[model samples]
Target: MNTIPVRVVAAEVIAEGIRLLKLSSQDGSPLPTWEPGSHIDVHLDPGVIRQYSLCGSCTDTSTYEIAVKREPESRGGSKFVHESLGVGSQLSISAPRNHFTTSTEADHNLLVAGGIGITPIISMARQFHRQDRAFELLYFTRSETHTAFRDELASGPLNSSCRLLFGLERDAVEATLDDALRNRHDGSHLYLCGPQPFMDTVRAVAARHGWPDDAVHLEYFAAAAPLDAEPQTSFDVRLARSEKTFTIPADKTIVDVLREHGTDVETSCEQGVCGTCIVKVLEGCPDHRDYFLTAQEHAKGDCMAMCVSRSLTKLLVVDL
Candidate 1:
């Protein structure tokens, strides 16, 4: 990924535990254009890169906006951003990448967001509004105090099309989601981003209502649960170009082994949520442990996230 130097133009607390950051080129030039649902990787510190969804208006090329929530048990990224990053701070960021792009073909868009997941959904709502497309936004949060972009969602043009549900129990949230999906019109597409449990419940409700996989789009910031619990089997991996083979132990990752053999692979979010470490699979079956790939992609077995994924077959050959 290419990196660009940017300066923090503004920083403000939008809600409890959430901070909004606006970034721009160091030279005051226009930044790269990005579509809704796009995200950029923030290089917080050496070996600490984290992806943040762009929440600013796509029309505004002068700046990029992202909201960061301080995790209770942060592994450094969020904590640093919240406590250390301030206005005038210089930072490096990757070019914008879109894995959760909006579908322009859909006649209507139903956007659902939970907690900080509102970041991407807000951009989609703005894009849809600008294009005069039919859409509705449903935002769920713990309370009004915890909701980001409250002023914008309440007074902006999208206010009429938005619904705020706060302090709901799990069953209540599920019921609300069921009703939303149950009443969805034909040609309407669903987009969601949120905590794993919330997303799982929403997706489950959509599935129960017969929503096709293509009609539902989602982005995950973290894994639903621990991914290393299963008993791992030792495997062999061959580099197609290098013609080098390595024995991968059950406890080690493919990236670690490759690094040990003097091979370098660009990686971010080693937990497998980011797609930075994906590599092509020339010949063997991959276990498909990453949350970044779709089910169809996993079934194809053509690429794998080397950071946390492994081979399913005894010997896997990859296009190094």
Candidate 2:
């Protein structure tokens, strides 16, 4: 499927370790109203598509802002966004989509961010500030200089009620988190965005402290690692649209198997993070692997991510 194109009209290096990119529509029309936590996948270079959370004000429809952090082990996407692309550059971006959102019903909001994961959390904070809601921000970073948006966050009006946590000087940040989770008031919702290890540590600590499962929400920036268990045995797949059957080996992904059978399906983020490889299912139980789908979408039993998803039965029927 073809995607819409967005142009970079202007970009500014915002704070330390962050670049605020300003994107606009190519035809001079108002961009879509993206709610808080909305993200767009930027199709850069030949085969690199990276998803970045919209860090600009959601109320602004004329343009969007995204903050990019130069990753140490970047595979050219982040470096390209930072060094190569600039003002007046044309880029392909998918429609604004959201997976992480604020729980409106919660009485208090607790936001936790690790390093660059503050992109979406910062948007949520802006929304909260606009709405005059009560919330707390616990931004964790290794050092003050490496943190993004340090000046804006420390001096901004939103910082009046927000708390900044640094792992450099003391253990006060972890103690604060422990105190908040331990002495929770009524209807407190916790939102977490970070790397895999950080998320795991926070989740484990929260669980150990008796935090409710339903109250903990997570936003991941990376593709989920494949399960460590042994691969399944050989299986067969039936494409409902083409009405063709093919066998899938345990060692091969459904995407490779389908393409080998001449199915020209489009895909990116082959690790099952992006929603690019999703397909509908006609029969048989599907083992979904994409991070895009919500818990509700899985219950419908109609869609599957072909990149890492698999069939439970020996013969599975799928809609291409």
Candidate 3:
């Protein structure tokens, strides 16, 4: 991954629980041009890395915008981004990457967002609005007060094509989904981002409505709980580039095993929400356990993020 050094130019609380951060390149030139739906991995406080979607408009070239929601259960990064980092603070960030890009091949677009998962989808909606494309947004949140970009999504040109669903007011999102599915035409594409159960329900309902697998795109913020709770067997991992092999116990993650062997791997959000520990998979099949990589890439086995993923075979080879 390409890495760049940036300095925080500004940090301000934008709402009750949301904070916006502005970061500029260290060299003072234009920052890397990122497409809609792109996100950068931020190395925040010590031993912490977090991923935040770029919220600034693509027309802007000098700085990137990201908003953070402080979770009550946050280990550190969110609090750091909210309280520690300020103007003139230096940090490292990964180049922008995207797996939720828009597809022009679709006849129409249907976007579903829940809570903070709205970040990338909002960027997609903005791009579609700028290009005068036809699309509708279904944003569901606990309440309008906690929803980000509420005014823009309600009254702007994008609002003309959007449907807002508030959990507090309506008590159920199923009616909205039913209407959207009924109005959805053939060749329409659906993009979804939210918690695991919400995505799962949407997927099951979409399948029931005959939505093609190829027509659905999703981004997740959390990994689904393990399907099986059986203890895993111990395995060996070989680093092909370093010609070194290490034992990985069933109870420890690959990240823990690699770190124990003195490998230089950086990780944050050990839950697999951050992509900092991503590495190339030289050989062996990977049992993907993260939410970072796309479904297509997961199938190819060309790469795996060591932070949360494990090997399927008895011995695995990876590029450190």
Candidate 4:
């Protein structure tokens, strides 16, 4: 991935525990344009890279904006952004990549976001609004105190299309979901992002409402399921390009083994959520542990995330 050198032009708390950052190219040039649902990998320090959605305007090429919510249990990304990163801070970021993208082809879009998940959904909303497309945004937060972009979503033009539900109880939430998803439209699609449990609930409810799997989309900021669910085992991996073979122990991941042997493998969010370390598999069955790939992709058995996925075969061949 190509890295862009940027400087923070503005930084301030957008809501309780949420900090918004505006970044611009250091050379006074226009930043690359990105589609909605795109994210940039922010490099905080050596070996400390985290992905954040581009929540700012796509038409605005001068600056890119991202919102980071302080997560106490995060893998150090959110904490550092909230406490250490500020205006004038220089950082390196990867070109924007989109894994969760919105489509204008859909007759109507249902956008559901929980807390910080609003970052991507808000971008989609902006794009849809600009195009005069049909979209309804459902934003849920603790309360107004914790609601980022409250005034923007509350604008007269968007008031009729967006719903802000604050501190709703479980029953209320379920009822609202039922009412919102009761009827399925011909070309309607649902985009969801939020805490794992929250997304799971939304998916379950959508499934119960007869929404097709292809019509519902989501993105994960971290691993959804625990990788430890499977028992560890030792295996051997061979690189198809170099014809090099290495033995992987039960305690070490493929990435660890490869790097230890001086073979470098790029990785981020080693927990299998980012899909950054995904490589093509030449020949082998893999014990898939990543949420980045779809179920259909897992069934193909042509690739795996080296960071967390293991080989089901004793001898695995990979296209390194």
Candidate 5:
């Protein structure tokens, strides 16, 4: 991945287990401007790359701020940020990319965030405020001590349009969602970012309220759930440009086999959380395992995540 060098200008604990890092261009020049809901791949070590949503305003191109929650089951990324990295640490980060975004043309926007998922939702809320667009934000967390950006969200400007709820059980959350989504403004779009289960509940409530799939949006920071329990089987892959065919064994992934055979495919989170390895599928059905693609896209069967997803057909003719 192409990356730009940046130095951490500030580092501080934002929430109970979350740390905020402010990174500025190493050359003291303006950085790339990014939209809300955008994220960048930060290379922490030689082979440690993780994607984090840019949380602060896009209007300020001088620096990018992101919040990293120390995952108890972290593979490496969060651990490094919490233990090894600090102010003055230099790192390489990819240019911002936004797969999750909303149209400002909407008459109203309803934003829902869960725990660390607030990172992206807050950004969108800020952008909406700047655009003077009608919007409301619902932040759900365990308690006040575990929430990030509490002061900001509780103050003027955002506080008027945002509501923070803590210690709500699933039933209560559902009831609240029912109230919030029951009578939404016309042309209102719903944005969701959070734990999969929480988003699932919100989605269920929204669906019950008659929200269409097109009017609902979601951004996932982790894999939705464990991979399917179905038995694994080998499949065939054909490159459209080279007309080359290869068999992907049950034990191996398409990218693994392709790279072993000298086919270049870029990937970041090979676990299927990130969409870095998504590729076009010209033929065959893909057993989509990634949270990066929507269910509608999965039904379309036009692309597949080569890193972790597998094919459902004997042969998959794909764009290299």
Candidate 6:
């Protein structure tokens, strides 16, 4: 992944435990254009990188904006951004990459955002509003104070079509979702981002309502759960191009083994939420442990996230 140095032009707290950052190129050049749902890999420190969605205007090239929510149990990235990074701080970031892209073919778009997951959904809302497209936004939060971009959602163009569902009981939220799903317009597409539990609820509701797999899109704020829950066994990986074979221990990752063999693979979010470490699989089936790929993509068995994913077969061949 190619990276460019950027300076933090603005950094301020937007909501409880959330900070909004505005970044621009150091040379004062227009940054690369990115579509809604695109994210950049922020290099917080050596061996510390995190993926943040680009929440700013897609058409704007002056600066790229992202919202970072400090995780209490964070492994360091969010904590670093919230406490160490400030205006004028220099940072390096990878070019924008989109794993969760919006569908322009839908006649209507339904956006559901929970907690800090509002970042990407709000970007999509802005794009839809810009094109004068038919859409509605349902934002769920614990309270008004916890809602990020509250002012923007209320005063911005999306306000008219946005519904703020704050401090609602679980049953109430379910009812609201049920009603929305019941009244979903024809040719409408659903986009959702939130905590794993929230997303799972929305996905289950959508599936029960007969929404097709392709019609419903999802973005995870973090790994759903621990990726090492299942027992792992040793496996052999053969690099098709390099013609080098390496043994990946049950406790070690493919990326670690590859790097040990002098193969440096570009990787971010080593936990597998980011798609940065994806590589082609020339032969054998991958375990498909990453949250970045869709079910269809995983079923194809042609690509794998080398960071945390492993081979299901005894010997896997990859196109280094």
**What TM-score does each of the candidates earn?**
0.93, 0.83, 0.82, 0.92, 0.95, 0.93
lDDT, candidates in the order shown: 0.91, 0.79, 0.79, 0.89, 0.91, 0.90
Clashing pairs in 2: none
- Candidate 1 lDDT over 94-183, as tens digits, reads 888887888878999999999999999999999899889999999999999999999889887899999989999999999999999997
Which of 5 and 6 is the better model by TM-score? 5
Worst 10 residues of 1 by lDDT: 222-231
- Candidate 5 Cα RMSD (Å): 1.5
Worst 10 residues of 3 by lDDT: 222-231
Give the better candidate number (3 or 6) by lDDT.
6
User: Would you list the rank order by TM-score, best first?
Assistant: 5, 6, 1, 4, 2, 3
Candidate 3 lDDT tens digits, 141-260: 877777888888888878898877776333267656766776557879999887787787777778778887778888776556762244576778888888999888888888797777
State each candidate's clash count.
Answer: 0, 0, 0, 0, 0, 0
- Candidate that beats the other on lDDT, 4 or 5, i.e. the better one: 5
Between prediction 3 and prediction 5, which has the larger lDDT? 5
Clashing pairs in 3: none
What is the overall TM-score of model 1 with all chains considered together?
0.93
User: Higher TM-score: candidate 4 or 6?
Assistant: 6
Instruction: List model 4 lDDT by residue over 56-141, tens digit each.
Output: 99899999999999987877788889888888899999888887888657989999999999999998988888889899999989
For every candidate, C-alpha RMSD to the true structure in Å = 1.9, 3.5, 3.5, 2.1, 1.5, 1.8
State the weakest 10-residue window (summed lDDT) of model 4. Answer: 152-161
- Model 4, global lDDT: 0.89
Q: Best-fitting candidate, measured by TM-score?
A: 5
In the range 134-186, model 2's lDDT, one tens digit per residue, is 88888888777767777768998877867677763335555666776777766
Q: Which residue segments of model 4 deviate by more than 4 Å?
A: none
- Candidate ranking under lDDT, highest first, comes to 1, 5, 6, 4, 3, 2
